[model samples]
Target: MNSPDIKPPGAEPAVKTHDNRRRWWTLLAVSAAQLLVVLDGTIVNIALPSAQTALGMSDASRQWAITAYALALGGLLLIGGRVSSALGHRRTFIIGLVGFAASSALGGAAVNPGMLFGARALQGVFAAALAPAGLSLLTTTFTEPRERGRAFSVFAAVGAAGSALGLVAGGLLTEYTSWRWCLYINVPIALFAVGGTALVPADRPIRGGGRLDVAGALLSAAGFGAVVYAFNEAEPLGWGSPKVLALLVGGVLLLAAFAAVEVRAPSPLLPMRVLSHRARAGALVSITLMFVAMFGFYLFMSYYTQTVLGYSPVQAGLTLIINALAALLGSTLIAGRLHGRVPPAMLILPGLIAAAAGMLILTRLTPQTTDVLPLYLVPALVLTGLGLGCVLPPTAGLATSDVHPYDIGAASAAYNASQQLGAALGTALLNTIATSAAASHLASARHATPTGASVHGYTTALTVGFGILLAAACVTAPLILKQQRS
Candidate 1:
């Protein structure tokens, strides 16, 4: 008879096969959750007009629907991450899914602006919890280096394509069906993920998980909330506005205080150890800067296609699908295949340069360039997508790699927060730049048509985006070098 500790002849392979299959299934569930989070950004953006019209929302009030989500998600991300560590990642993830589904249903049935805004805020609250938990799950599940690369690549591709896919989905749903379906759509997704949860391995939660630092949580939430609100206000109030400036400064101060609190607090929400690594810091910086440019890229592209090229909403949305598809290619064929063989800088440097080049090309768009799809948007989108593909997988790995098992959620949350802030700042900053440029062009060129002025403004902002991307590469280089040297 076999010893008590010994397995039967075929047991090991069978167990290995079972484990392998479970890992991929976990990835699928995680990816679906990620897509659900990301797609909401642009999907609701598309549905906003219809939502406003249906609910009889005023212009000023309409902005609140979007701002509520941004503020809640951005502010609560760190707290959410800590909660996951304390409660258990798997449990937090399912709770988030259930809450998100409930909120989506609430939004779908809303008959007033206040109700809609509250539901969207609820969605953001749950998403903040869900996003970090899912990421931690991925990191803990895939430990082998090469397989991690593959898993990250697949995950990054889904994230990279998510916004563009949102645009497409929003357009189709809003056009062909009711805007309510846009909110309704998430229910089925959440349910499917709930089912997929059965296959996910019950990973261990952080040790002594209940010792959360209350002060640190409060500080982080307020600081991040202030900063996000400041940026959101900047789009409407301008950077020089006293209210915006005050909020921005206050946010910075609160964040600094939070850092000090973390130094002394026994169970800090965001531990210093999570960011002590040079490579991880670099990764976070790179992703943040890329998003600062990328969101503006999407903003300008959508307007240029619709307002300038005269494409329908669906047509404008369709143009972005190419970018998503190209990102998929870049993630799978390039980064996934090459991650282990190369230093991250090898992929990262070239990716930034390529994306910058794409931004540069977009700076030359003319009102009459509508027919230049082959020579213009196609190449730009392809390059940007490929570059994003290269950057995301590598940076994602670096951001959370080699951290203490318990801090994984904190690290992942930090990365997500970087992305959220970057997007908020990008939209505000580039939009301000474009709006000012348009006013300047209109003043200088009496012959400029309104449409021409708008396009000119967009191109000018694209140039700023191009410069920002180059700056990002410069920032990455020395950080990577220092990490390498150490």
Candidate 2:
């Protein structure tokens, strides 16, 4: 990002310096927006304890802090895609940046849980716009294969490591200053992104774009929103509780209806063709599964380090840095370089396998494993980081690959929407699994200490995560390989 005049070595002779600068700036701005979304996912999590205490938030309301954002973003993403097409991607991106910054400011200045929740929801609304618009911008700008690969690598690496960076930032802010700074931090980042957007190439308008599909938008939003809220409520309410079941079933029906509407609509909220491509669909599924498993891993690591090891928030966050560093290596070094040459499955499948192996290593955890940093933690972090680093770039690229210019927004939205749903499901489902496992273990082994039971719960949940990762690999592997052969 620095020294705009200085190009990377081996700049193509055909490319002008001004063009190089614009493309790089575009990458920087889009990557920053992506980081904002991913970082916010976990940064606020670290600050939650402090925020809760200061706001007098009841334990009953804490989940809403997470749910409000996920629900809004997941539910509205499809509509956001349509909106991006209606309005220009560049315009939509700037609007999203301004709105997100304002919402972040409101969140920082919140006086009550209600205000905080509202602010979070507003942030999500803007993020739905920001994410798809940014990705589409990147896709349209970096048309060449090698340039696209490198640009995507940086973007993916930021996304892969952003959560850990959030942990680190949240810890430092919460410990050294007020927790409110965590939200306040977004203001400058957003403003910087907005400024950088000036260098971003404008999106050419889609010719003869059809009318907006109101029915599809409403159905998709309400459907996805309900599904996310259902999962969020599942841990406390019990999965089989009538409320959860009703919400889940209703959401599914609504989604089915949305799909049906898309089939007939003059202008669908998400064009069916966006997903009809087997590779793109598989990429979406893989992204969803990767996040579903990754978030749970993050949750347990944070808990185990802070609650069990009695580490400070900063120390806990610092422990995850290895994961981020390894991610950098894998993304830029391995996946980035090889991306243009190899099939996406080559990176994604092995990445999943490596992540599962890391989770398998963690299955050995016990409460008394006091010196886990050198033993259980580091290797697991490195493996998962490298794995995810390898996984994210290709999937992101695939999601937008071969997409029509008009449907790029839809494809991008689908990609990010998959990530949101995956994170929500992963956190809620895995936490529930961990809680239920701990309760069962305690009941079965009367002599087991609570700490031991907690560790057992974490390991059990991770074991499930391990299986999920492997299953995801299996599911997508054939899709990638078979399609390649055909």
TM-score of 1: 0.98
CA lDDT scores, all candidates in order: 0.91, 0.91
lDDT of 1 by residue, 1-486 (tens): 758999889999999999989998889988999998998888999999999999999988898888888999999999998888878888999999999999999999999999999999999999999999999888988998888989999999999999999999999999999899999999999989988989998976678755678899899989999999999999999999999999999999999999999998987899898887888988999999999999999999888888877898889999999899989988889999998898888888888888999989888887767556889899999999999999999888898888887788899899999999999999899999999999999899979989888989999999999999999999988897678677
RMSD of candidate 1 to true structure, Å: 1.3
Query: Over the stretch 1-486, how does candidate 2's per-residue lDDT look in tens digits?
Result: 599888787775546777889999999999989989999988998899999999999999987887888888999998888788779788899999999999999999999999999999999999999999999888889988888989999999999999999999999999999999999999999999999998887776576668888999999999999999998888788788999999999999999999999999987888899888888888888889989999999989888888788888899899899999988889999899998899889999999999899899999988777678898899999999999999999999999999877888899999999998898899889999998999999989979888889999999999999999999999998787886677
Model 1 stretches with alpha carbons more than 4 Å out:
368-370
In order of appearance, the predictions have TM-scores of 0.98, 0.95
Clashes of each: 0, 0
Candidate 2: stretches off by over 4 Å: 1-15
